[model samples]
Target: MSGDLHTEWARLFAASLKDSGVGHAVISPGSRSTPLALALARVLPATVLHDERVAAFFALGQGRASGRPSVVLATSGTAPGHWLPAAMEAREAGIPLLLVSADRPWEVQEAQASQTVDQIRLFGAHARAFFDLGLPDAHPAALAAVPRIAAQAVLATRWPLAGAVHINARFRKPLEPLPTDRGEPWRPKLAAIAKAGAPRLFPPKPAPDPAAVAHLVEAVRANPRGVMVAGPLPALDAPAMRKAVARFVRASGYTLLAEATSQLRFGLEAVRPIGAFDALLRAPDLRAALRPDLAIEIGAPAVSAQWLAWISGAEAPRRIVLPGERPADPAGGAAAMLLGPIAALLEAAAVDLEAAPPGADTASAASCYAASWQAAEAAAWAAREAAAGPQDGPLHEHHVAPMLRSILQHGGTLMVGNSNPIRDLDHDVPPDAAPLEILHQRGAAGIDGLVSGTAGARTVLDGPLVLLTGDVALLHDAGGLAAAAAVGGPLAIVAVHNDGGRIFERLPLGRDAALADDCEMLFVASHGRAFDGLAATFGLGYARVETEEALRDAVAAALAGDRPVLIEARVVAGGSATRAALLAAMAKAAVAAVSAAK
Candidate 1:
């Protein structure tokens, strides 16, 4: 169990992680990190990823999927720097991650060693906490502090708010497990301490404040026209919170508006949440008609621009935000921030609402408000279905959503990319679709690490894993193809190739006729390259689909296979026009339906 002081110290630290319930580790190979990497491999399921950035995001996906911190080990200096992007995402998303960076001794660091930088507090505000475990020592006092440091680091990742924690371990010249004469007497004691393991940690759960609950109940009573807005939530608690929220909506008689990543969007058809709210809200008439007197927002801010705009106007509804991990009031319009377990708060509110009796007029108004939202929801979906073109025609990005829903109908994990993919899925996928575990990096909302993150999630999750990303995002993380191969799972990457960033076309800059050339040159950054050769280089299965049927079959076959597959759906550039057309049709139809219902 021990070769040198560094070996013993690293083993003790790794054992503490296991004791604190860390189950997985992602390692990037390097010399300085040899001891910690070897130690972690012994106690947990470890994967070696060549790229540190990819490894960090891979660990991020694991944390998001598993609801526990996954260890990410890298050498000192710039290796840990690569983790900054993923760390920022983890912080914003409330995912737990443990980043261990190995460094040179203090003297060498002072002398400006080759692979050493100021590893202390490297992640700045992005990390929940930072620890610099100075040079490894075998003194009984020093060995005793190892487990304490590990415990504190792991706890910090989850407490107050879930995010990442950094531990910078500095080692002497012999970074390997070579024998040394420094700590011969402490060997048996160190082994015993490692064997005993650190004490298991149980974090306290925050309860809903009685005063806040009473205030929310009174607000709901006063405002019969209320709506529950469910945005992106922590994956682990989403299921429980979904049930609780459904109970609250029924008790309070409010319509539910759920985003795609909200987890409440699917599996709650009984509650009948407004599935097409993004399109429905686009119509000014409908937005005015459905203006809620009170809005109960849970989880992070939604991804829909229309939703944000609707909620930001002068007549915006009073927002009661139940923040998870962090405050989610980006519009700065929250009337109340209920700080506690969201499910618990919702459950408490539901109980209070059930106990109170509403007047007949209040009951009638709430029922009518919910009914109007339902009519608009139905109309929006009807319009989208009516506008569907022939399946055999040229592929468009709009087709990916329903095609994916059909492919993964039974059960699977769907990781959507940032750009148009997530937005499309949010607008198109309905509540009737089978419940699939949807994952996205909506924390920072960037398109950098979709492939590697999905691969990482595969290591922890069961069933087939599918990543629906754009061509540009796929290319950005092309190196992650190697990670997908190494992890070895049924991962189907559906890369929607629109030649470039088609999402930019929807913005103001793309709409300007004079800026067409500039938009194409800089904003879109079109790279007309096929992914077949890239797949071949990584030894992954490859398929190119241009028709709806082909896409369906390719995804089904890819899921059927055990290895990773890249299914590129090549569509013409500028599909945003088609998206705009569909939205306009949906909005018009929704307004008409709402007016008729009234």
Candidate 2:
């Protein structure tokens, strides 16, 4: 007759998740979630991470790359609690993450017993959809709804938009189905179940509405001098949406400034992207000159302090944010929003904008305006070049970004660890460098999961994988290396060994004398501990490179070998003092150069 309902429930859950197109399952170690965990691990290609927070973010990264929901599994109690930050990020970033957590059963939790707490709605607003799947049963309705519940969870995570969905699986144990418990019916029944497992689509993407297209085109026509800003875009399930974004930007006769995380930064032969806009916007004169009649931001707000300030200062009448999954103003400055799927909107607008006659003076003016911004961007970079002082000291912390761009092969991913590494990328990554795919935890922008997340991405990405992080960030999530070592992927970390939280040195908090007393020990927490021992502990290849050439060589050699490697580039991090001074000089020079421009 029927086996453990918990086993059947979990098997059905995994079946429907796989059926609904979830590509990967990232499970954490826990006793309560044993049945579901084992079922999902066996059914789907699974990765087991020790930390729930790291596992969730790693699942988040996998979602980013694959454009599909990755299941993050955890046991009852504080384990599910750790997934909140990543869940919040998934919601805001528009990445679909399905959280499969085993929760305490009602009877156990009712007594307020050990390892039992109320797990209902634990993630608060962070989860886009929440389901408390009651304790598994062999009842008719429940058994029938098992696959459908799994399929519905898939729909909920990605439905009208994309984000995190929480499935709190409450299990009454006899968690695993003992092979002997099945009696004599096992063999033939298993053969029949295997015959029925097939992939499915719970809900596909929406179609383009003609009315929505008209409104988008009309909005663009009204603003002839619009500039396109591409920020963090959602992980698109449709591949066509990917190409459509670039084509739309290119055909719009508008200048495009894309953030590194935006994914639109690459495949830009059809369009010359403004990678230097963050630095260029630093020159007040250039930012003012490029001020448009309308600012059409295609994605979310970028990670550029200069751009954020400049765009925020522009009059509200000039701001037009493309409709997000949610209706709120991400930029806090959107005057209006154009409604529709971004793919459909961009595809429709591309055709309409291209067809609009040259007789339409607005179209011609838009082209000239785009070209003018391009020329002005070149001038700003020229000023930055002129402002550069000779670096006779050790390889500057900023140089690692440009150097790694060459080492990672085409179609490779470079996930930037948070703090100075990402900011440096935003400020000075060479414009001529080949556009490698870049990923960032720009959601919460935390340093907690970089190691684990990088390890997660290597599961899906076939090319050379690298993590560009600093000293402190590495130490913050050092425990995550256990997962990395176990995953057995040849990973490379271009670690900038700046001992302390040196990122603060550039801000007023570091420069201000009032805060100098605690600046060293409290704010920065400088530690001169060695890294080789840490590498050995984690079974990672360790190389300390003193010169830029040696750093490059070490990174290449490490990537070529079979083990996970840590290539440490020694840099004196005085709170980014050197970077701050260099950028200031460049902005000053850029101001002088653009002073004559209209």
Candidate 3:
């Protein structure tokens, strides 16, 4: 094998992304990616990130918390255009990212060099596949086509099977890389490109079409005024994808309406989870007597603007839309899509409606509005226990999502962020709180890599991360506070900081009188500054609080500390009189629990 051709194409592109498994690589500081960042920090598990758009949303939150694909590299004008908003938020949150970009030759861009352009398909169609390792060579069939072009850029970001891909390498000017026992004679081209894996997983989609799952199991067993909706679960806290979203709400006895970044709103066992359907779907006679005559939905379209305007202003329900990836119907009210693998099309529509078996469904069937969604979820958990029973009020920025879910306990990992902290944790959590492994970017729900996508999903979630944010999404991700002061642990941000744009005073152009002075100098851009001197110029650990019992003892001493803190609960948009007395006591106990529905 001819030696030192950019160190044998950066050691066969870091041994084909460590033989296609690719756990993490992020890197950023350039010099044409120093021999592909010193051969991915001499073979795998890399990190560096000196802000290339917070290292492409920190390798798209470690390819969305380790479902794999996290290489990201970068080096070449506009450092790969700051990874096109983390490749359009990993092509709208289906996750999985590879990116990589080093580039230079094509005769140094036909000699107009000095950092060339047209870095080949620079993330257009926000990449699902774009490989072009066209130059740097050593030729043992070009070092066995650089680990089968780094295993098809780790299998086109593993798109509906993963998401962003783009490889683009090019290198020429002796871009470092000579040592390592003189490329140990290209070590058997890393087992013939790690025996070409990953090209088959997604090519097998045809199975779920049995008459579009028997008309989605006869519109979910002829609706007892049906409803399922769930949204946001392209895999996280996978227990066989949360028992295929609890076997599609126990063989479609419906009444789920999940959200609160649905991991089916809690570790659902005997189903029927509504998580106070954003205050029991704000009753219009209990949403006109639980309206759904068959709804379905499933993934994405979360942060509910009144449950997407009550299923896009219902007049007809037969909706459908199973969407595991892309089919965000937006009010053309789905009608019918049901493609495939939403956990084997909801476990073959629960064995064609014989039901019971996923966590062995126990109850929730008799519906005529399940006693008006259990008395409007017990008058929306007693108006969220009288908005956390006063306890010396003052903390109500929508009571910090049930006070960060009562400062978490055994269950951890929660991010929230984007505007009014994910619409006040989709209207204060508790329609029986359980599934707590939350993360919300809601794909392209941009606050620009909020704290580097929760410090790259805090290296695959174990403990200590609770972000919650919104002092203008922590000042539009103050360069993701250098991964919250160089990633150690226990982040616990909780920042409600009302200095401006309190989610543009609940939109509609913040009560427009022809955009009240451009919604208060451009969308309530108030500057009461103070983030405890920006958490002492980012060495973190600051507090501020005021009441709601010192913001619940500064969130139980910032989740019993370890490092990076911040607290700041200083909210006081009192003009909205404690969010108009908790949305007028959860809209007068949602029409007095649907006029005391019997």
Candidate 4:
């Protein structure tokens, strides 16, 4: 075999990717991946990162933000292992990602060759599809097939469901672009095949079954008291889908319970979604009064424990789920599953509602039911505001969350970190705020890659990007700060330094007084370091703010600037206790307000 075979094959594969609409590539520096790296760089906008894990998550962010797959290139051995977490997230979250691992040739299999492991199916079930492209060959047929295989791999990432796809490429020595002993016999044929170009493929959007739509419409007519639960919907970020969802909610008259990451929560007051469901449901009376006869869920499962428990209870409503690619019924209690595009299904339901007549007095009852939810939602937000006291008093997640609205008033992306940050943002941020694009790693709900993911999202975002993260989550992906800087976009990171894992403090383990010392030592894992020094290390501007005004200024400045900035908001120790107390107060106030309204 000629040494130029691998380089030629790599060039053809990279060209195929470009033809298939892959615009960005994240390459982790390694020797085995040199050919592909050079080829991809020539055809696409490429970002090189030192850590494989950071590269993978960065690519994951791009996929999530752009709704397109970003190719991730890594060398053989454990280097590919670092991508497992991001790959799992991509699969679970339905984000398109293409993972290409460069491997040693067949002769070194199980022979203890350095950086050589069984590269076949490295990502396992986490990937939507896996292909082992055998070693580069000069054979006419083999050379001609490289472009087709590359096109197929890219298409697989989006087809059945948008998820990760793997391509294992084996290479011989002379991975560089240097000429070898063999002449360029196959070059002309390869160029001819490349000139033909692969077809541009798009994922098929299955229309909602007509029968299923009619059944659901009939159910809506019978069930006056219905709830539309909107969960984490990253796919609904597109304007067309968001508008479709709004139309369905306004036409159906079902009380909408929208999660923070649902993309339907912040705007669309004309639809009147119940954004305070988390706090309002905490009151038993409100929960009982708001129970519905039917529940329709879209997107992924919700993040609220109270909402989950309430929906899955023994007296729970009969559930209908519109699961896009995979079944999202976590409680395994869905009465009917409608598999189709969410936007299409919603639009169909809205159109069908005009034809279906409601049962006698059903319309009046539904109106009354929706009115009650709106009243409760208003009470919940008012009660929360009353209990939060003066925003200038102390720094907490509650204060930090409301500040986000002002930062993105003109419109931008808000990336919320997992654990307490997401919960706080969900609970406190008002539904009437300016329209913004919000993203979170709710697929796995882990706090591993917050920084890198934010950085990745920045690459594709048109406006400023802000990340709300805890100290522990920021520290977990500290290396990602380098990647963020390298990407060179406007990014502001608000690090809530409340010592450590304050999220654990809200769990049962955190409240065990008998094991107070152990709980603090093990569960919270308190770290006393500040983020200013870390910011300096990464050449990012830093600020430490203790008051609300200072935080507002810091965030505004960061967003206005062209470089990345890290703002540390020091939360008072035991901020979790403060938050818990606030929730309790809000719950009590909400019940009284509801009772008075009744």
Candidate 5:
């Protein structure tokens, strides 16, 4: 009826993806995906990859970075299932990924079809939505599904509760055979637009009953050491509720332990920036300050085991939460689950409270520790600035992270590989005054999604994105580099090649006497000079840095270049001892300062 089975299949796949909000697709090559692969290859804004699992996670990372669903395309059987880890991650972390699994035609189904398996229900509970394509339906009905299925997948991914969606498709043979009058492939030029929907439900919610508010106020008023603890929250109407919360905190004279991921965490001096309450509670003075008659909980729970343990085992019998529906404890374990928003309830209370007394040192020592941490960061950067010099050749992974930071300037988002790259970055790069969004595959902590994530971030923001990765991560998503080059956007990759898994050498695996001294399986090593050739092969700008000066110059050049560039830095494994020594020196300075202040 048409040109060839592959052509029709390819057209449907492209149409479906384009109609959805997903502008990026990570494709892993295989025979089963010939039609889908050919379709993506001919289309704009699609990337072809070699590793099925990595490609899926790359797309998953892209979705996480961009705030949109990024599609994953792979051939059937284990190839489709390779997306399991990434799929599980997206489901839990609220990133959306569309899995397009190509399969054998229905005629060959369950008949020992090559590379065929029951792809349906494979993702099981991991996917938010699932659809099996290539049924006996008419072409018109099939065509009609292209847009709706795509949109649903993206919506399911981008929502607050996001997850994976599967589109299992089977294609007939002669996938892309020539036709007598094979016309140029149709490329749809329609722009994506928001769909018309019912008016959003922003129903007017009244404040908690005045008596209930009074109950909370009376509870706080009765206790001399009542305090407020705020946790991470979904985006709140900060401006609308700030005044109310401030008045409540002022009325109750409650010390606020604000988390950075919370609505009230920022824009306040008294509220401390302690990352994990557990870390703070370990200090004696901080634990003493937390000796409260009542702890008013708000929003989601904090990420501190110490805080929870302290509350669970308090000597003074702390009131860990105020009560109501949509309460502080999602697990129903808090002392009291307060009804209504804290700010609203507090407003009704309007109980008289005192300001923190001048020179009273109301804040815990942990608050001071946070300030000291800032000073240590400044001192670390000062040394780095002094020690900063140019070098080129095989690069040290340890050195690359900081140099990349210096090269990229302060504001752009940066994604790093796990293992050595991220560990190196966390140790070296100092905190900036400007908002620098640092991202990683921290949820799953995989090394396979660097390029896809970078590309997705590039699409969402008009700003530049630089990926500082190690050789393993680079090779894992090397095919993604081609996508970067093809897109011609603001993304740069700096790959540090130390040859083999340097992380292993630092582990017990390297030191075990049972292991062979020169075993290929355990103790592998590489000479870091291959990135230039690899970059050239992929049509990307290549810079080879061997000395300190050359490394700096190469980094500077890549940042200033037009297209996505790769700077390959090589160094030996043991070269990072200097960095470790420097960190230890700075940490000692902080420890000494705390001791001396006493």
Candidate 6:
């Protein structure tokens, strides 16, 4: 039967999206969203995905890759909930996801509405903003609520705190198809939806308060040994801060320590901080010498537990934080918080700070910082290298990361799988070289999204794309490889094969040798074979390597071609020895480096 509800919704929803700067949508098909699905299909840039969970993640990756919001459409009930894991990750990692879920109208809902679960607040804590665009009779509210809710959600997502937005549209039945004109495209012009929300853009401004700046400048000028730590900011905000803060830090004798994820790693007077200093920062001499008179922070929460803890305990001159309406850190106990634009605050201080004067003293301080960092770096690398080695000249986890790193350094873009591959890459990937835009399936950390994320990256980025994944990750997304290979692009899939689930084997449950056999039977369900054949089956090039040298050669050779290739390297399964040996070696190296520097 025909219905105006579906058509009205389709029109409103389509127009809302068009107005919201959403150029693409990743949709998963189903009955409840017939009208909505049709609406998305009519939208040119939208793409359809079969799995709702993968679709959500694919959209997340698309958002990350494109630097814009990507809508995820799914039918009602269990399907919409499939997005939970992705939703959690997006919330934490700060990506924009517009979740458009379809539902049965009110009367039919809850009393066996089939695919309905009071979805009004279904996502709850995970979503930054929530709205319900129910039936056409409520189209006015639907038009009003969706755009406003989404803007807030996206703003929260892009702000100091990141999260997703949820919009559930309940449709009344006979959910009819919409009539449209043919030939000419179905482009609908949307009137202003409730006088569009305020732009979330952060503008350049002078100091927020002249008095506050002057006080900060006076404090810095007085303290000879202060440290300025900058945290990770969104890609959009980091550059401007980097330029503004560079002159300020250099003027005072303060050292600038920036995190790897900070995006400010390239700017002037910025030194890459030690990743974590839980153990190192506790040292009596280091603590006393490095303690700052004042600490100024400008970015998201610091991820290092040690750094946060150290600053909390160390009696500094004062703690001044420039959050600018960003979320406050509950852990930053007793630190003075300032609510204003950071650049403006700095400018108001009007302190003419210069770079640390050159000479033996400056050289000495640089040496001290470099030596400390080198020691930590060496210890980490050594420990990881010791624990991870080639298994009988065949594949091993350690062997694969370095090899893949080698290949990627030679010009291919890298997409790392979640879990072990990323950790291994962190330990051994070449550090001195340019930063590789590392794409991780961090949202949900599922194994099913690698192929699609890698492929999506290839489409958006101009570089040669490489996906470094584990065996399980590769198998879970086997179909994705087929799609990628079929698409035929300059992509490479490198998998570190260790049978299955080595991460589980490190648990205390694995300590019982008698249980090991049972555990393997229940958990390590694996088919130890080359996925190269799978690629070849799809008419794609494939390479299976046993040793480090072979893998490197294969990767190098693959990079020379235009076709997509899959290189599988079988590694020794990680066990208790792997963990123990790695930790011990790292500790030993750390002490040694610290002793030598002293």
Instruction: For residues 121-179, write the lDDT of model 1, one tens digit per residue.
Output: 99899999999998887678888878878898899898878899999988876777785
RMSD of 2: 3.2
Candidate 3, position 303, lDDT: 71
Give per-residue lDDT, candidate 3, residue 247.
66
Tell me which residue pairs clash in candidate 4.
none
TM-score on alpha carbons, each prediction:
0.97, 0.90, 0.41, 0.97, 0.66, 0.73
* Window of ten residues with lowest summed lDDT in model 1: 1-10
Clash totals for all models, in order?
0, 0, 6, 0, 27, 10
**Model 6, 294-402: lDDT tens per residue?**
6776665544444677666645335667655555454565356766677656555534433224355654564565556557555655655665554347565656666
lDDT (Cα atoms) of all candidates against the true structure: 0.87, 0.73, 0.71, 0.84, 0.60, 0.62
lDDT, ranked from best to worst: 1, 4, 2, 3, 6, 5
Q: What clash pairs does model 1 have?
A: none
Off by over 4 Å in 4: 180-183, 235-238, 357-360
Cα lDDT over the full model 1: 0.87
lDDT tens digits, residue span 266-320, model 3: 6676765766675555556667776767777777765767677876774546688
lDDT for each residue of candidate 5 in 451-474, tens digit (9 for 90 to 100): 756655555555657777888778
Candidate 2 Cα lDDT to native: 0.73
In angstroms, the error of model 2 at 568 is 2.3
lDDT of 4 by residue, 229-302 (tens): 88888833556557877877767778888887888787674677788888777788888888888889888888
Give the number of colliding residue pairs in candidate 1: 0
Candidate 6 regions with alpha-carbon error over 4 angstroms: 1-5, 138-161, 176-395, 410-413, 441-458, 473-488, 504-542, 553-565, 573-598
Which residue runs does candidate 2 get wrong by more than 4 Å?
1-3, 179-201, 208-212, 234-242, 314-317, 328-331, 360-364, 389-393, 518-522, 592-598
